[model samples]
Target chain A: MLITNEVPDGAGHEDPGHPERPDRLIAVREGLEDLALGDELVTVGLRSATRLELLRVHQGAYLDELGAFCYEGGGDIDEDTYATYDSWPLAQLAAGAGLAVVDELARRGDGVGFVAVRPPGHHALPDRAMGFCLLNNVAVTAAALRSAGERVLVLDWDVHHGNGTQSIFWNDPDVLYVSCHQWPLFPGSGVPSEIGGLAALDRIVNLPLPAGATGDVVARAFEEVAGPVIDEFAPTWVLVSAGFDGHRDDPMADFALSSGDFAHLATWAAGLAPAPGRLAVFLEGGYDLAALRHSVRATLSAVLGDPSANEAPTNGGPGSDQIGRTLRERASTLTLVTAQRDAEEAS
Target chain B: MSIYPRTIAVGFDGSPDAVSACAWAMATGRRLEAHLVLVHARGLLDRFDRRDPRALFGDVVSELATRHAFNEARLSWHVADGDACSVLLRCAEAPVFADLVVVGSRGRDEHAGMLIGSTSLQLAERSAIPVVIVPSTTSEYHEP
Candidate 1:
């Protein structure tokens, strides 16, 4: 089930001509339409998150402040992020979509869920909104599961690093956060050296790619770097910060990934999950209309285990090889994880 | 003078439709000055399961109740260890009594009913108290 808020359909806005406009949802819907997914795709309207649920990820004061900000008719969180009259309630609905999807997946153990909500959440801090985001949806979901004594793996594939998510889970042992993002992008903080806090070195993983990195590198990063780490972690629940701005056509970033690459990445991640139903993807960022649309379709296909999903092969770039080497070197320090993976695979 | 029932009891299973029924019941309870009782059937699932069913579904129930809590009606919840329909019926016949018992036209099972779930169907048939089965198609009963 796709849990979504109708907010993207003109309920709110960032600016008049902003890239993260309401039409993005329409573009995504058009993409879903193009794929001819009848019963394969089911959609449920979002339930607004309760104040208590929001408190799971955000401080009480922050919630009160954001609520006041929105209720007072909207303002700017930063130069980039905006809030309107509809923004606060819509953000609540966006955060609620995460909870709904997790609830559905955990209970039914069936259909794959995608939360196509906005304002996009990966960049939002627990206290302040950033990069057109209000609340960190993926982070909120992870916190909910972790609080429930479930180990959660958050895989963020946005072009820009999921600094907000990483910050929230930086020292938490139960939640392992991994990101593959362009280094010199907005909210620039995902450096390779920033593994995590003192206790969480093995829990946080970042693959900071340079400009012009291809999907080939991303695929290799997951297979050689992210995959082995996930095997060792053995998380009970998997949450995806499914961002498509890495696509070559996106104006927001400079990565050369295609839609096939995004699908390929999702397939690999899905395989790493204990079960297909354990995986939930949340839309993060994808600015280019065609790129966002096709990438979303490809991701849905991959998550659904579609036999005919596209797999556009990479041309083999130096960008991927360098990242592979860096990760391989980092893997040496993660001896416990490496040994655990070996034992699990051998069994 | 409100024409609605004084005590409304709702059957909740965390399905979209069930959540919607809770919303509808709350609205009606507010109008009629009723006390709302939400009954969840844990006996429907396997008893051997390690986790507490209430703990697993507590967040959802809390969200549902909290949304309608500030209204005129008094909201309370109960976890029953029996079939949903049977438990709801028993609540209706209790001394405190439910004037109107509300339930979703369907439960969580996606394909169980053409329009109504077995619990709702049985409740509609056997319950002596007035029963209001909210259809999944009602736009007004969106999840709270």
Candidate 2:
């Protein structure tokens, strides 16, 4: 399932072009239209989350503040985050799209769902908006699942740590949050040691990479740390806070991931079968138009098990083998990650 | 091989964008018969030992230079301590003449604009010379 809302008419400004503009989604939609991927493509309408859903992970005061901030007529919320009048409603739509995707997948028995809404969510905290995010959509969804008595595994690969997602679930053992991001950038969190709360220690697995870390490093991190952890956790559902900022061409973060890497990661995630009806992805961030579009198609193709369906080759040749070597070195660290099932069984 | 003998300053931060920028710089320097300066800025090292930073920077410089076949004499590596954008600006202000300033763009988020990371933006906005914002996704070399 692909969920999206029509780009709000006349919502953008005259600022020097930023990556999180309407063009990003237009490029992605154009790419999908070009793919001719057949019946696999399912478009769904964007919806607004109810008040109860918003309260799932955010404080009431924060929501009230956000509403007030939007009502004041939109301005820079921070160095990176923007809040325009439409941002509030659009953010709700994005978060709601995330919840609806998860719910639909959960209700349909077994399938992969993708929410292609904008105003990417991973950077939003429980009470504040940062990094261009107004809502922690993935966290909200995870909170929803936890409330519904389901265990969730959140895999975030945005080139920057999903700090909000990590912080929201830090103390909750029911949610397993894994992030692969370039460290020492932006919000400047996600050190290897920021594991989680005492009870949920190790539930949050963070693989921080030096800048210039490439697709190979990402793949290895997944194969080694992320994949093994998810396998052990055996989640009732899998949620992906999919961010394309890691794309090699992306101007956002320094990690060197290719479209193929995104596809490979998606395929790897889809392999971990969630209980009966629970696997979904919510878009987070991706800036460059070509890279974002190609990466999104590749990710969806990977989830659907048909990468070749897209057909057009992305610019540039395959990446260096050094990326592969980096993955191997990083994956070796997983030897220390305790298996979740094994620990539970022993207990 | 002494054609123009220009100085090419390449910013290094151990990021893919930086590495690719360095690679592009080395190739450009070689093509232009210019000297290559691999400027590796020492970021906040409060948690890490100072010696570790020196060793790490030295290793990266040596490894990248040797792997790319740029002459040690033609390649000069310097490590400075400060904010990445500030350090880059300082380097640009130095007396050394540079034909081009090469840096990598981390891209833009809703928070940050089109120039991508702040460093790229700073260089683009403040550099005295032409700035090359190599996208992280770029696989091939771009001509100046």
Candidate 3:
């Protein structure tokens, strides 16, 4: 089910000056409406995430404090992040939407489910919320799947690194985490050398590009680095940390990706899943309203297998070639891991 | 006020023939003032599994539901993960759904004079309730 927090009360969690406002969801809903996709999209209502679900990815004390802060009329967790009286409920709704998508996909097996939620989650650490993120929505959902004994693959295509998601799964070998983001960006954590720790060396793959990187660089990184590793991992479920801030028009980032590039990346990533594999996309950080809407439509088109709906290819911005070459040259880790897995199985 | 307690489940795949079957179901649902549940089985394909059909056909379903909205009947949709026949069979027997199931006589490319398609045949044999196989010609009998 396509999920969104469409309730009128959702507006109470508002900060007019903040980029993450109620208008983001409005644009998403209107933009989807403009597409006029008949009988092809169904949206489910949002429910609040239970306290137990929040504990999956956040510290108990931090959760308690955050709830108390919100209930006490709310204030800033830090300079960039703020919470209102309704912020706690809205955040629970965001996290719950992700969990609901996981539940639907697990039961139905085949379907495209995306959550166009707010208060982006990739930057939120497990211990506390940051980067305008109140909770790690995708991390909580992934942790739930892990507890169910399902191997999961988290493909984060957001502009900034998915530091929180990576940190949550840093030690676990069952969840393969991959991210393609702009280097020298906020939170500054997605370095290639910072792959998984001692136990899960090759499980984490980071393809950090320069400011002017293009869609071609992202496509190549997926093909060269992510695809091979996913083929080796054979995860039972695939969850996407979809962030549209990488779009050329987005105000938040420096990446030069066009709207079509987002679709191209999603199409390739969707292929890594097994036949009829469940792909649940969690909305992260796309600040530009128009670009976000267009990118979401294009991504849906590609996922639904309509090539004609995708826009014509555009230039892969400046420095795209250098980034592609560098990733290809250093992408031996996935190959090495695949070969080892094959040998181990044969033995 | 919807007088009918039974909910009608129609097997739809966005095919022309399926559209005709939906029209028939809609007319019947209007007459009975029963809720309509459109079921599309987006089963597995060889290379990739079928994505949610609603992402592609939601407007069409909404339009159909609107046409019968005057009957005061609620319209809902389910895109299950299995093949059409089995999904329809399951829907027919489920407690939430009605015993009556509706389907197209034949899919897009089936013979014009054929009585039923493979899906319809399988559903007819396995369905616990009555199965209505509307032919492509039924489109003309209903109001647009």
Candidate 4:
């Protein structure tokens, strides 16, 4: 299911030469169309989230303040965040699209759901907008599912950790949040010890890699930490906070994950299931236009279980082995910590 | 007396650049016997929110404060709302007084270029105080 909105126009006005501009979505759509993915795609549009829906993951006062700022005409929401007339509504639409995708997938019984909305949401928190995100769409959707009696697992593979999502679910055992991001980077808060919510500490898993980590490092992280957690959780549903900013070509982050890595990860995720229709995905962050297109297409193809998805690019020699080893070590460390926590909880 | 002011106000928002600026401020604040004021603009938070930005900022400040032998009294933390440029400008223009301001070369989403970011450029353009921009790749901030 393709979930999108009139975000292209909204994003167009944010920053003219910015990397997170509307053209990124346009390029992805054009690429998918060129590849005829549209033939197999089912498109859907979403209305702006109601105040109640937003309040699930964000503070009402914060939402009010954001609206106030947006209504005031021009101001920066935070460092690296901007607001215009369209930003508030567009942010709501962006978040609403993610929820709409979850609802469609939950109702449809079978399909891959992708929300091509912008101004990414992973960095947003319960009360404020940061990292260009006004709302924590994935977190809100997961909360919605939990409220509806569905156990959820949120996997964030953005180059940067979904600190906001982790923060939101830190103490809740009902939702499992796992993220593999470049460490010593932005927000600098995803330490392994920062397991979530009181007494539910093991629910949050953070695998932080050193700078210059490559695709192999990320894949190994999935193989060692992320995949194992999902296998053990057996959650009722799985939600991916998909961010392609880890692409080797992406300028905003230093991780060197290739398009092939994204495809592999998506395909791997698609195979896990507590039910026939349990997995959903929402976009987060990716800057490089070419990498974003290729990565999204690769991920979509994997989600669709297409065997002929494009092969991993071979632009350079195999990535740094040392970094991969370091990432492996970090994941192992987190896995041990999580296991200990789980054991303690069981006792 | 020294030509450069001793007290430095650094702007941090948890980005790589922001972290670097914080590290720089810690070091510079120590060398000059000046105070380090880490100013971060808190985003809008509703009552239902659980995470505490002040606690997070305090963790970083306490870590640096202990390591540098700087008294907790000498460190100040401010959490405001709005743009980074405007916040920094306000601190620089405040009666509290600052000799210099430090920021990361590039923000979280900004690309590499001659100018760090629009906010940084604006801060440089508007501030009477000198500004320091540390590159994201720089090793100054990596040590624990």
Best by the DockQ measure? 4
| Backbone clash count for every predicted candidate, in the order shown | 0, 15, 14, 4
Candidate order by TM-score, highest to lowest?
4, 1, 3, 2
Question: Across the candidates, what are chain A's individual TM-scores?
Answer: 0.90, 0.85, 0.89, 0.88
Q: Rate residue A189 of model 2 by lDDT.
A: 64
- DockQ, all models: 0.01, 0.03, 0.01, 0.05
* Tens digits of per-residue lDDT for model 4, A57-151: 77777787777766766455444566687788888887787777777777877777777777788888776666777788888789989889887
Superior by lDDT: candidate 1 or candidate 2: 1
Looking at model 4, give its docking quality level.
incorrect
For residue A153, model 1's alpha carbon misses the true position, in angstroms, by: 0.9
lDDT of 4 at A316: 34
Give model 4's TM-score versus the native structure.
0.69
**Predicted structure 1: lDDT:** 0.73
RMSD values, in order shown = 21.9, 14.0, 25.6, 12.0
True contacts kept of 4: 0.00
Better of 2 and 4 by TM-score: 4
Worst 10 residues of 2 chain B by lDDT: B107-116
TM-score of each: 0.65, 0.64, 0.65, 0.69
lDDT of 4 by residue, B44-106 (tens): 221113335567667866776676676777777765544466567767656447778888876
lDDT of 1 by residue, A72-105 (tens): 7765443355688788888888888888877877
lDDT of 2 by residue, A69-177 (tens): 6777666553356677777787787778777767666566656777777777887777667666788888878899899898889999887788889878988989999
